[model samples]
Structures are given as structure tokens and as C-alpha cells.
Target chain A: MKLVVVQVLLIVVVAVVAARLFRSRGARAQAIRRLGVLAFAAFAVVSIIFPDVWTRLAHVFGVGRGTDLVLYGLVVAFLSFTVTTYLRFRDLETRYTRLARRIALDEAEVRGRLEGGPEH
Target chain B: MNTSRQVDTSGVWLVIPLYNEAAVIGDVVTRARSVFPQVVVVDDGSADDGAEVAREAGAVVVRHPVNLGQGAALQTGFEYVRSRPDMEWAVTFDADGQHQTDDVLAMLEKARAEDLQVVFGSRFLDDRTTPSLAKRLVLRAAVGYTNLTTHTRLTDAHNGLRLLRRDVVERIDITQNRMAHASELVEQIGAMDVRYAESPVHILYTDYSRSKGQSLWNSVNILVELILR
Candidate 1:
């Protein structure tokens, strides 16, 4: 009972902190990533406190064991995180590539003038 | 972009397309004047201080209040030269320094010998040619597209380096206002069955040219401009 109370309090704190941060940032992408981390932290605290909750939920779903339930949840979260991260990286990479090419072209034109080859 | 100054012995006249080439406008004007003798730099609604630079370079400046395309600049130049009896050949050059003076000489030579109305300079025809592989592919594609669409049957369809006879300058109607018009020049002229020639020219591809020019996605914008405008 005591452990459950602690878990409830920690979850509430996580939720409150996450909400505050999200409100200030307006659920911006960075904030959302941070929120995911905080959410996982809150889940960890909950699992540690109410050890029976995992097994109960797992059996309700006809899973073999409580650990299996937690493991399955983690696997799903990992996949989601990987996809989002990949998309974000790809977006950033494209933008940088464009910028780099532009700068390169500018440099070449300037250098051509300096070299005095007279090729326009 | 070549900065070395020379005397304008040739009776050739110059026309430049300007959007925001304020920094280099003076250089283009001065160098063109020293080499070609007569210069016309069109200010395509340059929000910057390009007008002042053009004047300093000793060019007859034509200002467009809004940013028009390079084709408009060429039109303005041609119109100006056609009115002037002293003007013989009009050279269409890029204000961005993609064109060099040596190519201008080659264009003049071809224009005079063939008694042709217009001469185009092809970068690919040059010995060293353009440096970038990506640019080579894009330019090749653009050339092929221009040849097929314009039926000009010229080697270098879109090269800016060209010397135009006063008669050709007076007649060719270049309606497209944006960058796509550069390639479209061949098509428009070909439709009229106008005569033209092409010779090798140098292209100095710097990082700036690639960046500031038409982008991969901008082709859609150009297509829409063609269809709608």
C-alpha cells in the first residue's frame, strides 16, 4: 500500500512537470521527445512500486508473464522512438545539404573572379 | 567573375540581367565597357543599390521596379540597342559572372563569320568545360529538353554567352520572364525558324552559382509559370 502511494505521487509529479514544460513549449518537437523520456521514467516508478500490476494486466491479456508485458510495452516504445528519430534526422540532413550546396556555389563564383581566368 | 580590366576596342554592346547584383554590377559594367565599349545593365527591380553601381560602371541603366527575369533584361537591352544606330552586335551576358570575356570574343567571331543573327556559346563544347558532375547532368538534361522543345538543332541551346545581330535583336520575342526563359530562348527562336550558331564557351561553376540559381524543386514553379503565365 505504501509503495503504491509513492508510485501514485511520483506519477502525478511526472505528469505535472511534463504538462508545464509542454505548455511553455506548446508541444514542440523537442518538448515531445523530452515528454517521452519523462513518461518512461514515470512508468518505471509505477512498475517498481506496484509489482503485481504488471502480472495482473499481463494475465488479463493472456500473456505468459508480467515481465513479458513490460518487455512488450518497451519494444513498442522503442520502435516508435526509432522511427521519429530517423524522420527528424532525415529532415535536418536535407536542409543542411541544400545550404551547403548554395554556399559552395557562391564560393566558386567568388574564387573565379579572384583567379582572373575570365570564365564567366 | 573575372576582374581583370581591359580597354573596349570592340564596337560590341553588352546587356546584363540584374535582380540583386548590386555588389558585382559595377564590376560587370566596368569590365564590359572596357572590353566591349558599350554596356546596358538592366536593373530587374533591384531592392538593393544596384542602380548606383551600374551608373558608376558607365552603363546605360534601365530599372525595373519589380524583380523580372533575365529574359526581360535581355529584351530591354535588345530594345535599347535596336534603337541606337551606333550599336552593331549585342552581347547577352550574365551579371552573376558565369560568362567570361574570352567567350564573348568567340561569340563575336562566330556571329561575324556566319553573318548570323545570333551566336550561342556551349560550355560542354569547351575543352575543360564545367567542373561539377551534378551540374553537367543538369545542363545536359536542360540542353536536350531545349533542343527537343525548341527544335533549334543547336549544340548549346541555353548558354548565355551570345552575340546577336541588331536585326535578330529587334525581332526575337522572348516572352518568358524568369530563369526558364534562358532555355526557352531556343524554343521561341526555333518556332520562328530563326537562324542561330553555337561555339564553345567557358563556365566557371562556383558554389554560389549552384545555390543562387534555379533549384531542383523550382522547375515546378517554372512549369506552372509556362502553363499559366
Candidate 2:
């Protein structure tokens, strides 16, 4: 119980420090993301300390041991990050496509405007 | 820093792109009046009175009804030069006076004598006079990438102080606006195997230029622009 309390205190301290550093960059969105990551790290720490919780998860997942449940959690986290990264990539692609279309339209308009200008 | 001491009189065209640069437009125009004969000031849809002052200063003013990028304004100046058969070479100059006005003749002389399709007045070519450390690093990285990708040995790729041959103007068309167009120029020009050289030049890092300068973050945009292109 003492170890758990100390771990929680450490986690909160790390998270707050990490969040402060991130916030200074003027990227509120990224700072929030970093806070979320810190929270996730805290959750992992809690899962690690409480072996019984993982045992319960193992029973639910029909796994043999608590370590198996931990492995399962890791796989889930990995897949989640991968999915999120893919979604982010898709969002970036859409944004860039729209941006390219806008530039193309702008170029056509300017070229037309120039060609239509006073003749030499 | 007048060109009179260095070389004889030569027909040098100064291309100044003005977009709401009216505050300093009169002073810049007045300054250029003494030097360049064919100074074409492209008013890129200035809401202010830049065109009037430019014309008053004996500069051949070209007004774009709407705000176009510097590249477009430059193209307009090039078109003007194209029309003028007497134009031996056209100098790509910045309206902000970040570039040295007197160095124009020197740059042109080097370009003309060397028979280079394009001669870039490089600040980093000689370490004797260089811009800020941050600027130098960014410019070096950009130039290095261009050199590697385009197979060209460009020491400073981002410097706008450049002289272009009358014929090579038709070969290259700059479409990218903002600052990324500098890197793109190397790729396009290199594709055509254009003869290029670098000469030492000075940069005036003024408060005005610092304020007007692109964000260091925007250099990433420039890199991405080159990558995408």
C-alpha cells in the first residue's frame, strides 16, 4: 500500500512537470495529448502494482496468468496507438488535398487575370 | 557602398515587388532612382499609395489589381523584361531592402562575365560576412538538401539576390509562394541543367526585416513544399 501511494505521487509529479514543459511550446493540443499519455502511463503503473487486477482480467480473457493479461493490455495499447496514428495520417492527407486544390484554383485565377490584363 | 567606384555603367534592371510597402516605398524608390535605369516596381495590389510614389521616383510601375505572390510579381517583371529586347539580364531584387542595392552591379558583372544562366549572391559563400547563426543553419540545411537532391553544388540556395539570363527566365517558372519557392527553384533549374554560380553578398538584418521574416517553423513548410514538389 505504501509503494502504491508513493508510485501515485511520483506519477502525478512526473505528469505535471511533463505537462508544464509541453504547455510552454504554445501547442495546447499537444500539451493535452502529453497529459493523456502521462495519465496512460500512470494507469499502466497502477496495473503493474495491483497484480490481482490483472488476475481478474486474465480470468475474463481466459488467459493462464496475470502476465498474460499484461501482455494483452500492451497489445491493446499498441493497436490503439497504431489506429490513432493512422487516423491522424488520414486527417493530414485530407487537409493537404484540400490545400492543393485551393492553390490550383488560386493559380488558375491569377494566370487568367494576368492574361486578361492590358495588352502591350 | 555605391557601384560607381567598382565598375563602369551597365544596364541593370532592379525588380521590386511591393505589396502594401507604401510607408518605405517612396524612400526605396528614391534610393533606387540614382542607380538603376529600368527599375520595375510591381505593385502587388497595394491598398496604399505605393504606385504613385514609385512612379514619382521615375520607376516603371506595374500594378497587379489583386495581391499576388512575390513569384507572380517577379514573373510580371520578367515578362516586362522579355518585351524589352535591349534587356541583357534581369536582377531579382527584394523590395524590403534586405538585399544590398550596390551589390547589384557586382552580382550582374559576375553573372555576365562567367556566362552563368543564374548567379546567386550567397551570404554563406564567404564566412567573412554571414547572417545570424540560426539563419545560417537553416539556409545551410536547405541548400544542402537541394544540392543532394538536384545534383547541384549550391552553397546558399535561399538568397534572393540572383541574376538570371534573359533566356533562362523562360525555362523556369516559380509557382510556389512564400519562401519555399527558393528550394523549388533549384530542383526545377537543376532539371534543365542550368549553369549556376555563387558570389559573396551582405545581408542587412533590420528590425523591419526581422518582423517581416517568416517563422522558423515555416521553414518546415518550405521543406515539405520541396518534398511534395
Candidate 3:
């Protein structure tokens, strides 16, 4: 099967999204993500008001139909959403692991003291 | 078993990350405590009374309020050991009773003889430990990936039995709350310029341990976690 231009573009976009998953999180990355959401929202409103604009843009991007373009966009958006959510959960898990470890150690210390002292 | 000629392992602490292994943890702790008196079982929010069993079996039990993964439990155990000024060495032992206490003693001897900071138990260094063919292949692949990525050449990257000095334990911070923590630990250790060696260990994959062991599918999750992290 022959690969199309849209296929290459979509693959590249997906690669970029995957790469972003490993990039260090910071205010700059957060700002960029927020701007992406704002731009996506603006585009959604623009497309809803002027549906023909998607078809025109699809033609410029070498996609056959506006629906296919929207689908590809949705795929990238969903992937980024999943990546960010996963990173956020990892961050939260690290924090809680530290917290739980502190409490567990502290409690163990108190119990050890109550039992007289450490077994060593 | 002679108490007079036995090596001074009072400074050594065996850290076992306990989960829902109430059926076997007590026995494991008791047996290990016979050789290494300082045994710490980090109970990772078990529904069973494994913590009580381990405590009664003469192991100091550290209970997590919620179920964190084995990696987190291990880090907690490490932190706990680090707090004890008397503990000079820490051994990360398995909770499933697969690791042999003799192997731990041998590793400790090797560490002390060579003055090494870390002694990793390697099942593939000899033909003593026999795993299933599929498990062997998966473990080889996992170790290959680990060696390639972590800049550390190890025959067994996922082995649960490892001996670390107090300084090495203090330097380690395992954030991977799952199977990936194995590779994460190795990677962190590799980054630290410390004297390290590997000792041949026999893993007794009994019917009980085989049933409790990690599935081969976790290799994929481990790879993903390492890449993403």
C-alpha cells in the first residue's frame, strides 16, 4: 500500500505528541498546553459557526474530507490528554508515596520507642 | 548455624516488601530472622493479617495506611533502615519466600570481602535457579533492555534480592510505584559511581512462589514506565 501525505503528517504529529510526554513539566510546558486548549476551543467554535471552513482547510492539508481532518485532530488531542493525565497521576503518586512513607516511619518509630528501643 | 563463628550480621537488615502474602510472609520472615536478626517487613496495606504475622514472627513491621506498590514499600523499608544508625547494610529480599537466606549470607560475605557498596543477586550467573522457558526469555529481554538503557551491565535486572550499603540505600529514591521500580533502581545505582559486584543466587521457584510471581505481561508495563519516566 502507498503512504499518503496525510499519513506522514499524522504520524509526525503523533510522534511529536509522544515526545511531549517525556518532556520535563514546567510553567512553560503548562503555558503551551493551556494555549493549545484555548486554540482548540477557538477552532471548535469557528468550525461550528463556519463548517465550510474545515473543508477548505482540509483541502489545503491534502486530507480528502473535513470529517477525516477532525478525526485526526481528535486522535492527537485524546492522546495528549491521556499523556498529561498519566504524568499528573505519576506526580500525585510520588507525593503521596512520600507522605505515606513519612507517616509509616513515624508510627514505626513511636511503636519502637514504646517497645523500649530498636531491636539492634 | 554456629552462633559463635557466624559472621557479624547484626548490622545487616533484611527489608522485605510485604503485600497480601500472609500465607507465606510469616514463614519467610521467621526463617530470614534466624539468619539475619534485623528483619523489616513493610506491609503494603494488606487485607490479611500478614503484618501481625510478621510481627509475631520477630520482624519489625512497617504498615502503610493504603496499598502502595512494592516499589513504594521497598523505599519505605529503605527509609526506615536508613533511620537506624546501627544498620550498615540492607538486603532487599522477596516476600514470596523465593530467595534463599544462604544466598543472602553469601552475598553479604562477598560484599564485605570485596569492600563493595552494592551486591546484586543474579540468578543467571549460574545454573542453580531454573525458571520456565518463557519466563527466562522474558527476563533475558528485560535485562537486555535494562543494560542498554541504564548503562549497567547486569545478568539479572529484576531480581528482588539485592544488598546495598547504608550510603547506597540513602542515595536511592524509588518513585516508580510498580514493577518499573526495578529498572529505576538499577538506573539510579548505575548513575552513582560506587563499587558494585554481582553474586550468584539460587531462586527457589516453588509452586507457591510461582503462583505469586509477576506475570510476563508486566514486562511491557515496565518498559513503558521506564521510557515515559
Which candidate has the highest lDDT of all?
A: 3
RMSD of each: 16.0, 11.1, 1.8
**Using Cα atoms with residue i matched to residue i, what is each candidate's TM-score against the true structure?**
0.60, 0.63, 0.96
Residue lDDT tens for model 3, B1-229? 4333367798999999999999999899988888898999999999999999999999999999999999999999999999989999999999899998889888888999999999999999999999999899999999999899886889999999999999999999998998999989999999998889899999999998888677888888888888776
lDDT of 2 at B23: 74
Error of 2 at A110 (Å): 18
For candidate 3, give the lDDT of residue B66. 95
DockQ of each model vs. true complex: 0.01, 0.03, 0.81
Name the runs in model 3 displaced over 4 angstroms.
A1-3, B1-5
Better of 1 and 3 by TM-score: 3
Candidate 3 Cα lDDT to native: 0.90
TM-score of model number 2: 0.63
Q: Residue by residue across A1-118, what tens digits does model 1's lDDT show?
A: 5445544654575555444433333357567668778998997898799988788876666666888767766655655555555445645544543343334334433644575642
lDDT for position B195 in model 2: 82
lDDT of 3 at A105: 92
Residue pairs whose backbone atoms clash in candidate 2 = none
